[model samples]
Target chain A: MHIVVCIKQVPDSAQIRVHPVTNTIMRQGVPAIVNPYDLYSLEEALRLKDRYGGRVTVLSMGPPQAETALRKAISFGADEAILVTDRAFAGSDTLATSYALASAIRQIEKDIPVDLVFAGKQTIDGDTAQVGPGIAKRLDMRLLTYISKIRELDALHGTITVERRAEGGVQVLKTKLPCLVTVLEGTNEMRFATMNNMFRAARYPLKVWNKESAGIEDLTKIGLKGSPTIVSKVFAPSPKAVKAEIIDTESNQPKDLVVTLLAKLFTKKPDLAHDIAKNAP
Target chain B: MSETTEPRKPARKKVELDPKLARYKGVWVFVEHERGQVHPVSWELMGEGRKLADKLGVELAGVVMGAPGEDTRTFCHQAMHHGADLCYLIADEVLRDYRNEPFTKGMTDLVNTWQPEILLIGATTLGRDLAGSVATTLKTGLTADCTELAIDMENRSLAATRPTFGGSLLCTIVTLNYRPQMATVRPRVMAMPKRDESRTGRIVEHPLGMIETAIITKVLEYIPDNLQGKPQLAFADIIVSGGRGMKKQENFQRIWDLAKVLGAEVGATRPIVQAGWVEADRQVGQSGKTVRPKLYIAAGISGAIQHRVGMEDSDVIIAINSDPNAPIFDFATYGIVGNAMVIVPALTDAFRQHLSTSRMAG
Candidate 1:
């Protein structure tokens, strides 16, 4: 019943800013936090470990400083930590990312066979929501994304039932063990780390794996070259020179403004006026 | 359980098992079908994928799975009309119902054998479920919920741009090394291409290959979704949408009141929708429905990128939120920085008094 929680170190969204001139994000000096979504995954893994009596391993792929995220994972009750870091692994997209991770998980398997893998539904930094599925795919495991609940878990039987939020409603799906679960946000409230756990995390000796150590054989397949898609450019969303026209909040009363707005609005969209009149309060 | 002190396993290098994934060619879009009808998002992806294929100079194709001769091919022809150069139709009895195992295998087998250069699917229930399994089986890169896709001129590759960081920023991802760079686009991101009835494409039929017995999961019954009273936001002309600025879940009732008066679909920001105050289907954001309402009244929604991506294309956007600096104001056609709780009802009252009275007077 050993569990693995995969997390990413992301620039805090609140502090993220796009370079006005470059139209690219200004990443410098932005403090990194555990991707908000990944926290839910970590919390879920911890809850499972507490109930199942198994050790939890926190793993991350980032630069050396990203060890902080792994340490933070330890503070939240992960028993072991692994940081897959290398200059080569930089710029890896979901595809290259999954390749590196699958190798590391296999390496971790030698230490302890991972029964369950937990990840955030999607990283704020990479909203593609592909990595979890990619990792699950590479590992040949079942993937459960947008999961609202883990209705039941029969660890002994290697069966898990969960509710996945679809477009219109939810679908209750069942899958066997060795599955990757990407948790939806707001699924559970994260608990505060105890002082003991915090101290343990701060001092924990993390295992840092380079590309070779991570079991990535083909150097070309683990980074930018491995990626088939390339970002030719990124620009800020085209902004309207004039923001939304201000409907005077003060001079014109709400009721009066409503009249002018309706007059102007209906002149433009006559059908809307008719539609509103047809469905009166 | 005690922590195991087992030593790590030595690395085993296998060349044959991990050989360069080869022979896979072409670009395919999964024509997502559910409840006997195909989702429009599938067509949208085909149009988008058509551009990506043309850039790579690859043939654009559609992979469809459904009951034998059950309008699936006609739907494939429709896809060809939209943009597909070829349609890979897999008609099987097992595929009539949208079960995971059969569709996953059917699509995966087609992919493994054909080795499409790129595979696109709509980010729908059937798409996501099937994409996850197929991508996993093929062990390739799969991007989801992309706002933009392009062929990187430098490499002639697919450049998938999506909102990263919960819509706070955007990231461009490439599956440079993987064949069939996989991605799923949310519906409405791409404009549905004009269909040409006269346009024709070759049809290559592929068998489901795997039998029903080979699949582990079985769909006992579909319980077709109850659509009788569903809100049709995508097709709505006038929409009264609410966001977190409404401050309280109960305040959404005001939006409902206004929408009821306008006969408009009620929409909400991703946050409010996720808050359980409304249905997820009513969510209008990057990960939700991209709307084109004729007249849109947004109550209390600050335009986050997530919400903006969905509603920005509206014919008219009128924002009403208490915060003057709310981002929704930036793109709205008009703005009123006052309590939606108060502003909405006032607007509602004003609309009722004017529209009803005008009707009576006329």
Candidate 2:
């Protein structure tokens, strides 16, 4: 079984800061890590490989620097890493990105038939959660998303069953192989890299593919040309008209603050006090 | 690679869309329903879609696909009451429960036959799963989790505004030349339109062309979430949420203590949820639940734009953080700069006593 996990290199969103004066993203110091959500998928893939005795290939699409992310995946026991990077791939939206990645996966399938594909539920940067399904549709694969648990994998019968999180219930779904699964976050803890695996990752030669190498035949279906969505405007959200009213007291004691806060809140919005009381246990 | 030019920077250039795409004429909202209950996000999208439709001088329509039953028909009427000028109803057994195969086929076929200039869907799990597949099958552009949707009059396209880079910045996206300019808006992002019981509209019936035999995937079982007593943060009127500054898991109990006293739901920031201090369902943020409660008391939250977007619409925001410079104070209605550990308990006690005293007086 060849399980290909799609990962992304994104700026550590938690650490990203916006320049106060300019209101522009301060990307200079932001470190790029493998999209945190993708780690769960990668870990799940690694576990599957350990059990099934097959190869776990990690795939990513980004700039050249994305190689570091794939190497990190390698250190965590991914058998192979492929980076699909190209200048033409810049400004690719979810649709264009999925098209390019699907083409690359098809290319990978030429060497080894892929039985299953894994992807993060969503990327932190885009937060779209569309690319996984887009890839599944492009590849004509069964798309299983928000999977909480992979209950069974029947290689002999060529099927898999998993628990998928829906709105208010968990749906136990059984589907054919050659399917794509996007695992929910916190599905499993990512394993720490071993020293020997770290050495292997450091020395491992990575496969770097541009558009042509990734088997992207249609030029229009890549990068800016292929992207139908255009950013008409980018701006910062306007701050609220009023700043918060700081509740101050003589002693600056917690009790004093609470008393002032409650008094002020009730005096101004009496309805709120009534509402709270109505809901009180 | 060179930096990509901003699409707006080329303001002087004229964009000629494909003539074939120009024929798409109406606005469609996919009304998602499950077990006879329609998701509220569907109504929210319908409300947004009405404005877009009126702006575009087109009819607003809802697309409802499910089993051929009273429930499907009931959803159509609800859609009309919620501002849809018409609803495209596709009823079939295969679509009773959402199976990607038949539903995607039904949606894409409807789009192909009766081309809509714009399509809106709720950004729920079911809608996202369907929209992505349908958009791909049709090769159309789809923007997800849009906070704002409007019509750009120049070329008459859908402008989808959403938080980017984890909510630090907002970007307006437009599907310049794609027919059925598709977008998904999360629940609570848009105001719920007041329903008109007397409102009426047209219902166009469509058929699901596929059968269950053709579908590869099967739903083995559905274990309903035992939500008898779970956090319903999305609809909670009063929410008391904790953040990273809560220190640790033990400290989270204080948040619950306050919530219990006030009958407020307990919420957590994404970090706290990720750290296993709270369930993911209790998380309130850009990636979690978007809540617009009457009062939101945030303790120890630094108010990153992510967590801010989810709760910013609350009628009143009370931020409690030790750091005076915490961003939460910037927009909160009331700011208390003190250790959340102390302030949370004090607030709980104060509210408990205050409410009891008020009850006696009344």
Candidate 3:
């Protein structure tokens, strides 16, 4: 069985801060790391490899620096790593992105048939959750998203069973192989790289594919020219007209502050106190 | 994914749209229904779609796809009450459970038969699953989790606004030349419209030309999420949320105590939830639940844009954080720059005593 997992390198959004005066992202010290959600899918793929004894290949599309993410995946037990990068792929939206990644996967299929594909439910930077489905549609693969668990995998029969997270329930679904599964976050804990594997990751040579090597012949379909959506404006959210009223007291004790807060709060919105009293146990 | 930060090309004289695409008209909101009830986000989109339709001098229509039954019919009427002038109904047994294949086929076929310029859908689990496939199959642009939707009259395009960089900034996106501009808005991002039972509209039934045998994926079973004891954060009247500043997993009990006294729901930031201090359902942020409770008390949360977008619309917000410079203060109704560990307990005690006194007095 051959399982291909798609991953991405994204700036740590948690550390990203907005400039107060400029209203722009302060990207100075924001470190780039593997997209957190992808780690779950990669870990799931590794577990399947451990059980089924199949080769797990990790793929990514980004700048040259993204090779670090691919190497990190190798350290986590993936048998191979591939990175597809080019200037022409810049400014691509989800549509263009899936096109590039799907094209790359198709190229990879030339050497060995891919039985299953795994991707994160969504990327932190994009948050679209469209690329996985887009790739599935383009490749004519069965799309299973928000998968919480793989109940069964019958490689001989080319069938798979999984639990999918829906709006109000979990759907137990069965489908034929050559399917794309977008793993839900918190589904599994990512394994830490062993010291020996870390050494291998440092020296491993990654297969870097340009647009053409990835089988993307149409320039218009891989970059800004191929993107259908255009961003017109970017700005900061306007602050509320009235800034919060700072509550202060002479004692500055928690008890005194609460007492004063309730008094002022009830005075301003008298009905709130009554409502709270009526609702409380 | 399209993070085009480069300055947009200067606006030119109104450019003429493609003749084929120009034929597209009306605004369509996919009416998402489950368990015989339409999701509230569908109504919210209908309300939002109505404004855009009126602005463009077109009609607003709701697209309903589900089992052929009375329940589906009721949803169409509900859509009308919410503001749809008409509804396109595709009722079939194959679409009963939202298997992506049949639903995508039904929606794409409908778009082809009756072209609509703008397509809006709720950004729920089902909606996202369907919208992505439909948009890709149709080769159109789709913007997800849009906070604002409008018509750019200059070019007759749909201007969809959404947050980027993990909610650090907002960007307005436009589908310049796509025949059917597509976008999804998260539940509660838009206000629900007032419903008028007196309102009714025409329902156009269409055939879903697919059979069960043709579908490859099979739903063996569906385990309904047991809601016997779950956090109903989205609909809570009052919410008490904690952040990392609570310091440890044990500190979450203080939040629960305050919530119990006030008969409020418990909420936590993404970090706290990720730390397993609380269940995923209790998370309140851009990626979690979008809540608009009447009273929201946030302790220790720094009010990142990701968390702010989720609850900024609460009727009254009280923020308790150690840092005076925390972003929560900029928009909170009342700010207390102090230790949340101490203040949370004090507030809980104060509210408990005050409510009991009021009960006795009344």
What lDDT does the true structure give each of the candidates? 0.76, 0.90, 0.91
Residue A54 of candidate 2: its Cα lDDT? 90
Clashes within 3 Å, all models in order: 17, 0, 0
lDDT string for model 3 (A1-281, tens) is 99999999999988899898989888899999999999999999999999998899999999999999999999998999999998999989988998999999999999999999998899888799999999999999999999999999998899999999988889999999999999988899999998988998999989999998999978888788888888888899988899888889998999999998888888888888866765677
Better of 1 and 3 by DockQ: 3
After superposition on all C-alphas, the RMSD of every candidate to the true structure, in Å, is: 6.9, 2.1, 1.7
For model 2 chain B, where is the 10-residue window of minimal lDDT? B1-10
The TM-score, computed over Cα atoms with residue i paired to residue i, of candidate 3 is 0.97
Predicted candidate 1 versus true structure: per-residue lDDT over B217-287, tens digit per residue: 43332234577778788867889998877888877899998887777889988778768999877988765
The alpha-carbon deviation from the true structure for residue B356 of candidate 2, after best TM-score superposition, in angstroms, is 1.3
Question: What is the per-candidate TM-score for chain B?
Answer: 0.85, 0.95, 0.96
TM-score of chain B of 1: 0.85
What TM-score does chain A of each model score against the native chain A? 0.92, 0.96, 0.95
Candidate 2 structure quality by residue, lDDT tens digits, B1-362: 00122445553246677999989999999999887799999998889889999998899999999998899989999999999989999989888777777888999999999999998888888888998898889888888889888877888878788888888888888887788899999999898999998999989998777878899999999898998888898888999999988998998899999999999999999889888888888999887899999999999999999999999999899999999988888899999999999999999999999999999999
Q: Evaluate every candidate with DockQ and list the scores.
A: 0.22, 0.63, 0.70
Residue A68 of model 2, lDDT score: 99
Highest DockQ model number:
3
User: What DockQ score does model 3 reach against the true complex?
Assistant: 0.70
